[model samples]
Target: MALDPTDVGKIAELARLEISEPELTSYVHSLTQILDLVGQMNAVDTAGISPMAHPSDSPLRLRQDIVTEQDRRQSFQEIAPATESGLYLVPKVIE
Candidate 1:
């Protein structure tokens, strides 16, 4: 797909980008090449292929989901400026 200067300018306006004329010309060329590349990639046939998170078959190694810290809520809450019923109290800023 070919992108003209007007199209590029509209895209830049929508993205809130301040682009100069020289940069707009450069971006037009670069964006046109990227779209062409994406079009070519989309033309490939990948029938009967399963989607994968990674190319390799190795499973992800993750740490066990277990609590590793002692619960010191009461000790920490004692130093706070305001706390009530195991929850912190804050001023109502909005009316």
Candidate 2:
């Protein structure tokens, strides 16, 4: 899949991009190389390969889930303008 200037121009137009003439040539070369790499990769056989969640097989280490901070909800609510049932009240702006 080789990308020419015409194809690059159409791609740029479809993407709403304003590419200059010199930039269009550069894009054509770069995009053509990328497509060629993809074509090469697609030519390989991977029939027996299974999908993996990760590249490595090691299990991830996790930290213990516990409370590390003291409760300050009551102190914060005392300083607020309005709070009811442990919730801060705000003025309604929409009908």
Candidate 3:
């Protein structure tokens, strides 16, 4: 799939970019090569292969669902600029 210079110009206009003639030519060539490579990859046959999520050497292990934290309300509130009734206070912005 060969992308045209005019198409690249239109894309640049939409993105608010000023692409020069040399850069546009380079981009078109690179994009064409990438499309060609993808087209080549489309010819591969992978019919019944299971998709592996993670590729790791060792056995995967998940941590148990447990809350390992201490309640630090006073410590947290101490850093706040303004606080009211154990909650951080913010300026009312509604008209």
Candidate 4:
């Protein structure tokens, strides 16, 4: 399941990445190792095994959502460089 250098070169070209010879060699080696490990999994014979989300059977606990704060809009707007009609102002970009 090793990736071809030609495929790598094409992928680099499509991604606009500048791959040097050393980088290409390093990436190829790393990618080859990953492919070999994945290939090893195909050797396993899991004929009828159920997939699991977690190793344990316990459900995860979650926190209750609560509103705990309020914004001081007038106090915040007082620090703005520009504001009008209860809103911060910015330079108009289009007519």
Candidate 5:
């Protein structure tokens, strides 16, 4: 997965980026190294290993789900220019 200048140029073009010649060379080198590292990682075997949600084994501490703010939907919608069936309506700009 060694990225060449042409590959970097195509990528930059696709991403709508205007990169200089020096920057293009730097990006090619950096991207090639990243791809090589990914390739090396993919080469390792993890046959029986289970996927982990987090790297650590400790459970995450979470706060209780509670509503702190009062509902102001009705008040907001009352000031809107258009609303219908509890939903804010907007002008149709598309056909």
Candidate 6:
């Protein structure tokens, strides 16, 4: 699970990042430790344990869904710079 300079360079290139030689050394060490920790975690035996969505067993409480506010679209649209058919318009950004 050790990461070398070449592995760090490839990761930096793929992520569009610029890493100095000093920073690259630090990154390599940190990444290697993280990978080693993950490797250790993966080596643990969990054959009898079932997968869970949450760590706790508490039930979640949900509120009733209902409209609690009045629509003010016309008032807001009247103050907008551009509006057409109750929809706001903006300048085209892409060709």
Off by over 4 Å in 3: 44-95
lDDT of 4 by residue, 1-95 (tens): 78877777887899999898888988887888888988888878988987788999689987779866697889999999999999889899789
Compose the digit string of candidate 3's lDDT tens values, residues 1-95: 78889988888899999999999999888877888888897687878977677777467788888988899998999999999888998888787
Lowest summed lDDT window (length 10), candidate 5: 35-44
Cα lDDT listed for each candidate: 0.94, 0.90, 0.86, 0.85, 0.90, 0.93
Q: List per-candidate RMSD values in Å.
A: 8.8, 10.4, 8.7, 8.3, 7.9, 7.0
Instruction: Please give, for residues 56-91, the per-residue lDDT of candidate 1 as tens digits.
Output: 879978998999989999999999999999999999
Q: Candidate 4: where is the Cα deviation over 4 Å?
A: 6-21, 67-95
lDDT winner, 2 or 4: 2
Q: What's the lDDT for candidate 6?
A: 0.93
lDDT of 1 at 14: 98
Q: lDDT per residue, candidate 5, 1-64, as tens digits?
A: 8888999999999999999999988999999999988888777798999888888878888878
Judged by lDDT relative to the true structure, which candidate is superior, 3 or 6?
A: 6
* Alpha-carbon runs more than 4 Å astray in model 2: 45-95
The TM-scores, one per candidate, come to 0.46, 0.45, 0.39, 0.45, 0.45, 0.46
Worst ten in a row by lDDT for model 2? 42-51
- Candidate 3 minimal-lDDT segment of 10 residues: 50-59
